[model samples]
Target: MDARRNDVNPQKYYVKKLCKIIYFMGLGDCWYERTEQSRMQKILYAIWATLINSFIILNTINELLAFLRTDLSVKEKNDSIQFRFAHPCLCGKYIFLVLQKHRIRALFERLLEASRSVYTVFEVEKRSVWQAKLCCLVLAASSYCTLLFTVVDAIVGYFTQGIKIRTEVVLYPTPAHSGLLINLLRLLIEVHWWCIVTNMILVDCLSSVAMVYVAHKLMIVKLYFQNLRQKVISNIGKKSDLEIQKEYEMDFITGVKLHKDALWCAKNIQYALGNVYSIQVFESITLLGMCMVKMAKIDINLTFILANGLYLVCVVIITGVYFSSAGNITYEAYEVHNAMFHSGWELAHLSPASRAVVLVAIQRSQVPVFLTAFGVVVLSHNNFISVVRASYSFFAVTY
Candidate 1:
C-alpha cells in the first residue's frame, strides 16, 4: 500500500489500482490503448473473469432459492437475518454494480484519458491529497486482509478442527459436511466473494479520487479569487485605471471559467454515481438494520458476533467514505464563493464588461455546487447522517 518513492502522483497511483481491479474483474483494460496484443490480452482476461464470476452469479441464484424454500417460522431469528436478508442486500448492490460494467468501463475510460492529459498539472501533489489517497488505500487493504484471514482460518479449521459450516466462508447454501468437491466449491465462493468486495472497494476509491479532483479545483478557484486584486495590481502596477480594470476583467473571466470546469467535472461524477447513490440511499438502511439487529441479539457464538460486527463497521466506512469526500466538495465550493464575495470586486472601478463578468461568476456561485444523485440526494454529511438515523430506527423497532 506504500507508494514507491519514485511514484508520487496520486492520480496515476489510483488509476493504476483501478485498472488492475477492473482487469481481474473480467472488464477489459481501461488504461491501455487498443492494439493486437492488448486485444488478445483483453479476450483472455474476459474468459478468465467470466469463468470465475459465473460461480458467484450461480451461487447468488442458489442463495435466493434456498432462502425462499425455508419456512417463514424458520426465518424468524437464528442466523437467518444475515444469510437471508443482509447478504442478499449486499449482493443486490454488487449486482447493480456488475450489471453496469459497460457504463463503468466507459466512465473510467473517459477519466483515464483526462488524467493523462492533465498529468502535468497534478504531477506535484499536495499533502492533503496524498493523505486522502493513503486513507482510501488503507481502508481497502484492511478490509481485504480481514476477509483473507477469516477465509484462511476457515480453511485451516476445516482440516485441523472438524467439519463445520464456517459462517464466514460458506456464506452461500452449502452442505454442513466437507468433501473434496464441496471444499473446492467453498473455495470458489470465497474467492468470488473477495472479488465482489474488491469491486466495490475499487469503485469507491475511484469515486474518492474524482471528488478529490473537484475539491482541489475548487480550492484553486478560491485561492485565485482571494489573490485576485494583488495579482492584477502586481501585474499592472503603474498602469492607468482603464488598463487595470481590463486586466481585472480578464483575470475574473479565467477564474470563472475554471470554476465552471470544476463544476462540470462534479456533475459528471454525479451522473456516473447516480445509481450508486440510489442504492446507498434506498437499501443501505435495510442492510445496516439487519446487521445491527443481528449484532444486538444474544448470540453466544464469537464468530457470529465478530462477523456481524465487522460487516456493520465496513458498511459504515464505505458509505462514510463516499459521502464525506463528497461533502468536502460542497464545503470547498462554498469557500470559493466566500472568497469571491470578499474579493473587493465592487470597490474596483470597472467598465460594463468587467461588471457583467463579475455578475456571471456571482450568479453561478450563488447556488452551492455539490454532487447529487438524480438531483435529490445530495452527497453530503447530512444525508449520510439521515441514512444512519433511519437504520438505527429500523434496528430499534426490530430489536
Candidate 2:
C-alpha cells in the first residue's frame, strides 16, 4: 500500500479488536487516514474522547467523596477504592498519548514496516512472530475476560438488588424518585460504570499492546542479527572483494542503527507508558491487599468473589505482559551483541573503519537496553516477583 495514495490500506492494522475499541471510544481518530475521516467526524470523536475522560474523572471524584462522606460496607469501600485509584491513571496515559500521538505514530509505522521486512526476508519465519501473536492473544483475552465477568456480575447484581450504585458515582440527576424513574437512574449509573470500565480497559490494553509491538520489533531486529550473514551476503553474489567489504560495512552499519532504533523505541515507549505502569504496580498492590481484607471481613456472594478472583488474575497477567515484554527487549539487546560474533563477520578481510563499526556495534549492544521508571523500578521479571511480594506485604498489614 502506498502511503502517498488516498487508499485505506493502513486501516488494516485498525481492523483488530484492540483498535476497534479505541476507535469507538474516540481515542482512535489518529488511526484513520486523512481522507477516511471528515473534519466534523474528527471533531466529534475528539469531543467524545474528552467527554468519556471527563465522565471517568468525575466518577472517580464522586466515589472518593462518597467513600469519605458515607458509611459504606467494608466490601463496597474496598471495591470502590480498588476501582477508583486504579483507573485515574488512564487520564495521565491519555494525556501523554494524545500529546505525542504523531511522534509515536511514526515510530509505530517503522515497527510495522520492520515486521514486513522480516516477513519478506524470512518466508518460513521463526518463533518471534508466533510469540508476539501469543502475547497479543493474552492481552486481548485479559480484556475480554474482564468485560465478561464485569457485565455478567453487573446484570446479576442489578436484577437481584435494584438501583444499587457500587461506587456511588451517579452521573444523572434522577432526584424525583419513582419506580420507572428509579430504574432509569439505576440504568444510567450502570452506563456510567461501563464508561469508566471501558476507559480503564482501553488504557490497559493500549499500553500492553504497545509493549508487545515493540518487543516484536526487537525480535525482528534479532532476526536481522541472526541472519546478518545471509542478509549481507545475499547482496554479494558477484561483487569483488572491495565491493563485498563495503557491503559488509554497509550492512553492519544498518544493523547497528536498527539496534539503536529498537533501543530508542523502547525508551520512548517507557517515556509514554512507563509511569502508568509504575503507578499501576502500586495501585495493584493496594487493590490486591484491599481485596484480601474484604475477603476476610465478610462472606461475599459467589459472583462477587468470582469477579474479584478474575481481577486478581488479570492484574498478574497484565503486569507480567509489561514486565516480560521489557525483559525480552533487554534479552534481545544482549543477544544482538552475542549474535555479532556468530554473524560470521570474520569471513571477510576488513578495513579499520569496518572493524571499528563492528566494534562499536558490539559495545553498544553489550550495554543491554533496559526499560525503567524514573530511573528506578526496572521493568523485568525480577520486579514482577517484587510486585507480588509488595502486595502480600500490604495485605498482611491491612488485614
Q: Cα RMSDs of all predictions?
A: 5.1, 4.7
Q: Which candidate number has the best lDDT?
A: 2
| Model 2 agreement with the true structure over 1-399: per-residue lDDT tens digits | 001222222323532455566668756533433436688987887898778767667755655555553545555556666656665654565555566666556555555454353232232123344555566567557756765776676567768876353334332333234588777656655666666556555666666656665665566566666676775566565777777787677666666677766777777777666676776677667877877777788666877777767877877787787788778777767777777766657755688877877887777778867777556878887888998888889999877
The runs of at least 3 residues in candidate 1 whose Cα sits more than 4 Å from the true structure, single-residue gaps closed, are 1-10, 30-39, 68-80, 83-124, 145-163, 168-173, 176-178, 235-237, 301-303, 373-375
The local lDDT score (0 to 100) that residue 304 gets in candidate 1 is: 44
| True-structure lDDT of candidate 1 | 0.63
Overlapping backbone residue pairs in candidate 2 total 0
Model 1 TM-score, all chains together: 0.81
Compared with the true structure, what per-residue lDDT tens digits does model 1 show for residues 96-182?
556665555555455434433322234324544685587577659666765755555454545754535343323344454467887
- Model 2: how far is 398 from its true place, Å? 1.9
TM-score to true structure, per model: 0.81, 0.81
lDDT of each: 0.63, 0.64
